[model samples]
Target: MHTKDDWITTPVTADLLRGALDVERTEHGVLPHRLPARARAQCSDGQLAMAEAQPSGVRLVFRTRATVVELDALPTKRVYVGAPPRPDGVYDLLVDGRPAGRGSVPGGNTLTIDMTTGSFETRPGPPGTLRFDGLPVGTKDVEIWLPHNETTELVALRTDAPVEPAPDPGRRVWLHHGSSISHGSDAESPTTTWPALAASLGGVELINLGLGGSALLDPFTARALRDTPADLISLKIGINLVNADLMRMRAFTPAVHGFLDTIREGHPATPLLVVSPILCPIHEDTPGPSAPDFSGLGEGRLRFRAMGDPAERASGKLTLNAIREELARIVAQRAADDPNIHYADGRDLYGAADFAELPLPDQLHPDAAAHRRIGERFAELAFGAGGVFADSAPPA
Candidate 1:
């Protein structure tokens, strides 16, 4: 057994983080941010702040010969006011881009939320350690993907051997923006999120900006997307807009156009695919500002309900169906002038049939199995012959 003296400690820094747009030096260590500071400053919503800091697609990448690696972090876990404690967020380890193992840290701060009232409170606690042992005993690239749901402040990284930044393999970079489904909610692990799995299959580098409950087409978010460097880009729109009930049809159309215009400012000709939301039964025809269905709260569980009336959609309120139609129209019209813009029906990703085979456990987010199905379907649709990203894969 190795003693404490056998480990070499390395300070966590921005240079080692992948899939993060920016990093903040925290009191304890470093916190990764998907949206940069400027964008973060524009929004005061606690939901978006928590989602971006949770590190859904962020991971530490390094080359080391160590058989054991440990990361120290201060993770802020969420607790629903009346639900059973959530399973600890999972950390996925990959060696040479393949799954090596998974683990989780315990005893961190808890943020208790009252979904019914949109209220929350946080209680602080000490940091914890996450360790992975028995890695292959030679030089290799190792990635420690942070938990996709927990807000983590990376404190330290330690390995038995010295570490260096992993050399880039010159893969095409795919940047994606979307809502919770794309943020790995209910997914088994960080790498199993649809975008991550699709990125693995497509052999591209991933930069996911999939903020949960926060993919509304905010101008700052669009500007961040515009400035971020990427070879190919994708936006999964609709679900969040409907869920938040943030805008009416009059605003949604102009907002969509403005978002696209911002991104095109930086990436004029990049293959930009706009994806509509997957089939969500409750919101398919109904408009929403979805509400918490606490019926399951007695069982220590929680579910969501779309609260908008179907009739309201005729008043210009957004529904998944309406959003999809508008998105298709917008992309088609944009494609006429800018041939690089494309559209994909998200129902193609998690449609009615797939929903039957592997249903979304919650009315909102896809479960782990559904995430896999969506990921595989996305790989086939987006990277297969003649797909928008068909030519993006690195040469075999």
Candidate 2:
């Protein structure tokens, strides 16, 4: 015998007893083809029903059957090169068909995109997906131009939902810098980038400045980080520098210090985490192109060589071990003055032991499965219990 208010107020109550469980279910048949009408309808009338959008740049969203809203991120314009003569492929970007940007994928699988001018050049991108972002807030029509070899397929589009202005300021920001592995290379979607994954898990807003080939201790990048706003910061170094053979011990040592010193200029007391490169065979003790072979025929058929002898690393090259040793020494020296600074060996997130079990298919970038493993490990080590980062709190 309970009053109406009593029944409603019960904290741990059974809905069945109250007859409030009028469960209703409906199964909508899947629709095949690009730009499903329903999705397009949601985008019509210059209205969008989405979580977020960028008024002036490309916004990427990743979804899968397991998780409908899998991941999303605004594309970072910074690009990098892996090998020379970068591959040549179609550069397709359409904003109502006026040509927002254009570039061809070169041979090295490199990418160079100019955000300000809306231009791009990169090697052939991974296949089987298409995305567009940066539409004017009230776009009603969209025309696309495809690469010579590609066909434009409208996969999906949605107008962003209006965002309510927040009354309170957001939490302290965390800025991170890293390589392709951090740039979501081979990640199932743009949002699955390890940094993004970790950020979501940590509940911190992020400024991911992961430039693929460009992470090699560049002065400009250091300057950029120094100028940016951040309360917590991190730099995932080593692999790219090793693979690119960008500098030797003579220059590498100073460059590392310079990068850190530059960031400290802006964040004198902010917590900074320096992450070593994760386990990458091609660049781990072994010089790059660790193993290479040729098969098939024609110009596009011959594969480049890689994976040389690990013992040869003694010849003044940047290897993972070399970077690790140097980073440890550098951090130890700096830690004396900068107590807020921290160091995290990338292997702590994904180590040689894990590599033995889950080798990167390309011997460079981790595949999708590896990305998940790395993401989980990163979330645990960099953002888990007793971790240095305190910016991210579990969502309420």
Q: TM-score: which candidate is best?
A: 1
Local accuracy by lDDT, each model: 0.91, 0.52
* Model 1, C-alpha of 274: deviation from truth (Å): 0.2
Pairs in clash, predicted candidate 1: none
TM-score of each: 0.97, 0.58
lDDT of 1 at 89: 86
| Residue-pair clash count for candidate 2 | 23
Measured with C-alpha atoms, the lDDT of residue 278 in candidate 2 is 88
Global lDDT for candidate 1? 0.91
Model 1, span 1-396: residue lDDT tens: 668898899988777889999999988889999999999999899989999998998999999999999999999989888788888889999999889999999888999998878899999999999999999989999999999999999998999999989999799899999999999999999999999999999888999999999999999999999999998899999999999899999999999999999999999988899999999999999999988778888686667889999999889999999999999999999988998888999999999998888877778999888998899988888888777888843332
Q: What is the per-residue lDDT of model 2 for residues 1-396, given as tens digits with 9 covering 90 to 100? A: 323233211111111111011111212111111112333344332111111111111122111111011011111122422222322333433343234444332222234634334466645432232333444554233322222111111222222332111222264566777776775565654345576567657766556666554477766567667776777788998877766566777888898999888888877887788999887755666766333333322232323234556676677667888889889889989999888877888887778788888877666778777878887887787677867775352321
Among all candidates shown, the one with the greatest lDDT: 1
Off by over 4 Å in 1: 392-396
